[model samples]
Target: MDLELRHLKVVTAIAEAGSLTRAAIGLGLAQPALSAQLKRMERALGGELFVRGPRGVRPTELGELVLERARVLVPAVAELQEEARRFGRKRAAGQGQPARYRLGGTHGPLLGGLVDRLASACPGASVTTYTSWSTRELAGLLAEGRIDFVLTGVCGRSRPPSGGGGAALVWREVAVDPVFVMLPEGHVCAAREEVPLAELADACWTNVPGDGCFAQCFAAACARAGFTPEAVYETDTASCVHLVQVGRAVGLCRATFPPTPGLVTRALRGSPLMWRHVLGWHPDSPAARTAEAILAHTRAVHTRAAELSPSYARWRRGHRAAL
Candidate 1:
């Protein structure tokens, strides 16, 4: 048999773990099965990769050479596989792919608002929404001609993802929103107009999973506030809300999240983290033809969502410069 990615992984695993038996356990394969596979691999490669001993196994000269290459190839192939999976999921979900007026977005309220406005504005066109937690994935889709536009947010001073293959994309600033925390209405900090990040040092947190650097920024903010944050859970939007409502954990959210019966969304004292909304499109795509109109509607929706949140609205009034 020719060497494949899995074979390369087997070689790497054996070298790292120091024995076929141990590697088998780590790989969740029976030792005998692992040995059989190793033998086949060695035969295909025309040499033994290990020297078995009472003390366990050590890499032979050929084994060391193979191990060196396998170490590099395995991780590179693993990265390739991961990227393929992300793109595949997004692609497979699109049966025939692009709609007349298609939009790709990360989780947010603006996407829905834009979809509605697009449908109303272009009465004869079809409006579709493609959602993912990855902004890069959206950029890739735009580059591949699978989507017409993208609406997403970046934390702090982060820039938008670039469309691959030198595709020029035009990104418009729609709104600036402060990241906020959600707490059970009965919590002590819930009564405050602004919750301090340091006060939540003992709190467990949750937020909708996103492929952004916000978690790093959050940790850095906590460091500045003189405390390391407790557990931060990653889950879907509904689960995040449930976690906060039941008091199992608190949540991080955009300032525009609407009020729920038993939970309160409060601004952080220092506005340590901020979310900036942006809409993007390939300048050559048909969507660019009307990007200006869509951007205006997106900004309007963002403003409306912020105004609906009492805490955020109050905070906005006092911190105009910060926003």
Candidate 2:
């Protein structure tokens, strides 16, 4: 079969993810299907592209060569698509064409408010939002000019991406959201004002299934508290919340998370666990021109949301300088 852009995308996704399972998930494909497709591509190209191991897959010499070409091709294709979209919009509406601003982020309390504010601020512009589990992937999209900006959280010593077209990206810290533990309302520690990380060492935890910044921070905090977290469930944000609500497992959440009816959020005692939320964009992009106002509005929205969380309010009282 002749090669296609989708095939190249799959190869790059697998290489970047370092595992077939992870690549499949990121691409929204089933593992077996992705594996079969990879095999077909290898046969068509007359050689295997990856060195498969029990832990993950790595690019072979041939794979690296192909991947380097794919990287350039894929981003160029994305740029073409973006330009085509602009052309279509202009042709369809003439001088009345609306400016389109694409925004991306993971789950966050201020997301809705931020989107609304952006729309209100640019009356003639259309705002679109995208969601992804990995901020790094979102950054790649920005570098490809697929999105205008992104708002995301980073944990531990994780820094934002700074390469390729993304080298022009500028980031501003909008807020510091302290982490909290979410437990079933009927759990033993649910009534406590604060729960010690060590106290929940034996409890089953619901964990996001990757080594992203948030997961790394969670693992590091658990290690410092003297135990590795026993993750009983690996899932997305919504599932994690459901698991906690049903008493199946405990989970971590940001201060601005809305209170769930069957779950209680408590501050982690003596722990400095927190995620820094940042608004990032290419400095030369049109969206960046209004970034200062957007950031100010985002900060105000997050501050109001954080105040709604009793635990965050208490923490903010002592750490006013950090905010």
Which stretches of candidate 2 lie above 4 Å from their native place? 1-47, 52-99, 120-124, 163-166, 209-211, 318-323
Candidate 2 per-residue lDDT, tens place, 6-56, comes to: 689889999999999999777655587689889999999989999999999
lDDT of 2 at 52: 97
lDDT digits (tens) for residues 1-323 of candidate 1: 97876577678888888988899766655687689889999899899889999988999999989888987886685567446545654664565333377789988777887787778877877888899987867876776567878999888778777754355678888988889999999999999999889999899999876656787799899899998877989988889999999999999999998878889999998789999899888765545657787788888888888898899999999988876
Error of 2 at 104 (Å): 0.5
CA lDDT, candidate 2, residue 317: 87
TM-score quality measure for candidate 2 = 0.74
Per-residue error for 248 in candidate 2, Å, reads 0.6
Write down the RMSD of candidate 2 (Cα, Å): 6.4
TM-scores of all candidate predictions against the true structure: 0.70, 0.74
